[model samples]
Target: MLASPLIEFIAREHPAFVHVPLGLVAALPLAILISFLTKHARPLTGTAFFIAAVGWASSVASLVSGLLWGRQVNLIPVTGYFPVVASEKQVLQKMLQLHITASLVGFVIGGLCTWLLWRAWRREDSPGFAERRHAGRRFWERGAGVPALVVALLWLGSWGFSGKLGGIMVFGNEETNKAAADADRAKRNDAEADLPIRALDYASLEPAGAAPERSKAHGDRWRRIWVTASGIDDYQAGKPMKPGAYAVMATFTDEKGKPGTEPGPLYMKETKADGSTAFLFYWARVPENLRKEVGGQDSVYWRSPDPKLITCLGCHEKDATPAK
Candidate 1:
C-alpha cells in the first residue's frame, strides 16, 4: 500500500498539473500582444518559459503519483489470476499506465516547445513591432507540435479522472462513515487512557441485560483474523474500529468447559434494513460453544481503532456503538 509520502504527493500534485498548463496556452497569445504593444516579446518569452518549466515538473510528479497509486490498488492484475477474458480492470490499468508514461514524454517535449516559443518571442529583427509579433507566432511553429500538444492535453485530462479515484484511495471514503477513522481512534485512545488498573465491579461496568464486559492484559497475544479491506491509509477501511481497538472474546468456562460469565467468541449476523443492509452481533456466552478459533489471514494493521478484528461481519452488529 502507498504510505504518507505518496499520499501527500498525490493530494498536492493534481491541482498543480491542472492549472500550470493553462499558463502556457495563455502565454503564447501574450507574446503576440507584448510584441505589438511594446515592440518586444522578451518578457512574454520569459514568462512562458518559466510557466512551462513548472508545468513540466508538476506533470512528471503527477505521472509518478498515478502509477504508484495504481500499484497500491492492485489495479494491474496478477499475470494468471483470471483467464484472457480481460476486464475493465485491465483496460483501466493500460490506460492509466499509458497516460502516465505519455505525460512524462510530454513534459520533456513541452519543455522544448516552450524553449522554441521563447526564442521566437525574443526575435525582434523585423522592421516594426507588428512584424516582430508575426515572428513570435512562428516561434510556436513545431515539427508535429500540435499533435504533441493534443497528447499532452489529453493525458492531463485523463490524469484528472484518475486523480478522482486516487483521492478516494489515499483518503478514506467519508460518505460511508459518519466521522473519520482517526476521530474514532481518538475516542478509543481516550477510552484506553481511562481504563482502570484494577477491575471494576462487573455488574457496575455493564448496563442491564448486557453480558459483563471485562478486560485482561493483552500481553502481546496475537490472534488470527482476515483483513476485510485495505488501502494506503488507516482512514480507508479499518479506521472505524477506534484506537486500542483490538480485543479478544474467548468463552468463559469452568474446569469442565461449561459456560460462565467471561469472554467468548464474538458472533455476528445481518439485520434487514429498509433499503440495503445492517448488522447485529453479540458475544458467545459458552466457552465450549466457541469453535476454538475463527479462521483469518495474517494481517498487519496500522495504528487502528479495532484490534482483535472484533468487528466480524454478521456477528457484532448488536454490540457496536452507533457508528458515529
Candidate 2:
C-alpha cells in the first residue's frame, strides 16, 4: 500500500493543502469584526461570507489529505476513524488521535459559522435592509453576525491547535528529537556489536525441509526450518549443531486445524562459542487476535537474555529435534 505513487503524492502534499483553509479561517474573524463598525455593512458582510464559505469548502480537501497521509504511514488504522492508542507510552498515536479530532471539530464549527455568515449577508442585501439601517443599532449587533464571529473564533482556535500538533509531527520537538536520537544510537550500537544480524536475514539461509510441516511443539502451527550452512548437515543427521551454528524457524498460524496463510513468529536458535544455546523470537506484525500473546503489542522482538524468552527455554533445554 505504501508503494502506490498516488498515495505517496497525496501524503506528501498534506502539509501544503492545510495552510490555505487555515489562513482563510484565521482571517475570518477580522472581516466579521470590521463589518460591525461600518454603516455600509453589506459589502463587508458579503466579503466575510465569501471568506467563510471558501474556507469551509477548502477544509474538506485538507481533511482528506491528512487522513490519507495518516493511513499511509500506518499511524491510523485502515478500518477506523481514529488511531488505536493501546497505552500512554504510544505518544505518537495519542497525538494523532487528538489532531484528527481537532481537525474534524474545526470543520463542523466552521460549517456552522459559514452558514451564520451567509444568513447575515443575505439579510443585509435584502430590500427592507435600507429602511432597517436607519435604526440606532448596527445590523450585525441584532443579527447572526455576532454569533458567527464567536463561532469563527472557536473554529480558529481548533485549527490552530491542530496545526501546532501537525508542526510537531513534521518537525521534531525536544522530546521526539531525543527519542529519535536514542533509537538511532541503539540501532548503530546493535550493528557494531554483532548482535544476531544473521537472524534478521534468516530467509537467506538453507531450507531444512521441502515444505512447511506441522509442529506440535510450537502451538500446532505449521513451520519451515532454515539452517546456516555450517549446521544443515548436522541438523539433517540428527546430530547436535556445532558451536557458532544457528537455525531459524518460520511459523504460520493454523486454520481449521491446518496451516493458515497468516504468518506467526520467527524463532531462532544459536549455539555460542562455548556450545551454550541461545534463542530469539521476533514477530514483526502480530495479528490483532493474537495480540494478547505478546502483551497486546502490535509487534515484538525478543532475543535470549531477555526474560521474555524464558518461555522458549521451558520447552527446549537444549537443541531438540524438529517436531514431526
Candidate 3:
C-alpha cells in the first residue's frame, strides 16, 4: 500500500521510539527485586507505578507507529515461496496478536498493582491509620507485586521475539546471499576477479528514464543505468545480451546527490558462463578497489552471488528485454 509522507516518516523512525518503551518496561522487574532486597519500599513502589504508566503510554505509541509503518510494507508474499498467498499475512497477524496481547495484559496487571500501591500510600497519609496502612502495604508489596513482575517479564519476552521476527523479515536476505557465496566461493571469486574488460561509454550511453531511476532495490539509493552500445542494441531489438563479451554498467548516487557526483557504488554486469548466456554481477566503489581486489586487474569487482540480494534481477530480468 502507498503510505502518506507523514506515515512514511513515522514508520521510518519507529525503531527509535520502540526502544524507549522496551527499556522502560525492562527496568521494572529489577526495580521491584531491589525494593524487596532493601527497605526503601515506599519510594520504589511509587517510582515503579510512574514507570509503568509511562511505559504503557509509550508501548501504545510504538504499536500505532508500527502499524502505520506496516502500511508501506508488503506483508503478503508476492512470490510463490509461501504455501499460500497469505502465509506471510498470517504470520504477521500472529506476531501482532502476540505482541498486543502480551503488552495489554501486562499493562492492565501493572495498572492494578499501581492502584493498590496508591491506596497503600493514601492510607499511610491518613491520620491514625497506621495499622490499616501496614496491612495495605503488605497486601500490595507481598501479593500484587509478584504477579505484576511476572507479567512484565512475559511482556518483555513476547515483544523481544516479535522484534526479532520483524528484523529477520527485513534483513534476512543478506544471510542467504552469504550462504550462496560460501557454497560456491571459487566460482564467485573467479567471476569477481576475472570478467572481460568490456567498458561502456558512461558519458555517451543514454540515461535510463525517470521510471527506472528510483528504487528500494539498492536500499534508498538513486540508480541510473548507462548501457553499453551492445546493450542498447539488444534492448532495442527486444533480445537478451548476445552470447558474447560486453559489459553493462550502473552508477548509484546517494538519494539526494547528482548523477555522477558523489557516486556511491558501480554495478557491472558481464557475460559469464557462455552457451545460452548467463550474466554475473560485480560491484565496487572505485576502479582502484576493484583492481586491488582482483590483483591489479582493471574493472575487477566483487560479484553478487545472488542477484536478488543486490536487487539486480528486478530491472535486468524485466527491462533488459521487452516482454511480448
Q: Which candidate has the highest lDDT of all?
A: 2
Candidate 3's displacement at residue 234, Å, is 41
My TM-score estimates for the predictions, one after another, are 0.34, 0.62, 0.42
Model 2 segments beyond 4 Å from truth? 126-130, 138-144, 186-249, 252-324
Q: Write the per-residue lDDT of candidate 3 for residues 1-324, one digit (tens) a residue.
A: 233687777777777787877787678677666544545555766676677667767777776666665544533122312112222324444454554455556556556655654554454445664444434555445422565567666766766666665565445556544544564775566533464243334556645444435445544456666556656666556666654434444555454443444454455554443523244444533455444433343433444442233345555563254242
Tens-place lDDT per residue, model 2, 131-179, is 5653465554544368898999999999999999999988978866776
Worst 10 residues of 3 by lDDT: 76-85
RMSD of each: 15.8, 9.7, 12.9
TM-score of 1: 0.34
Ordered list by TM-score, greatest first: 2, 3, 1
Global CA lDDT computed for model 1: 0.38
lDDT of each: 0.38, 0.81, 0.53
Candidate achieving higher TM-score, 1 or 2: 2
Lowest lDDT block of 10, candidate 1: 223-232
lDDT of 1 by residue, 1-324 (tens): 334785857745554554555444444434333433443345544554465556666555556554444444444321212112123333333444554444455555666655654554454333564353443654333221233344435534544454554444445366313334544676687643343211212222212122432322221222112111221133223233333222222224332333454443332111223322222223323233332332211222211112233344333344242331
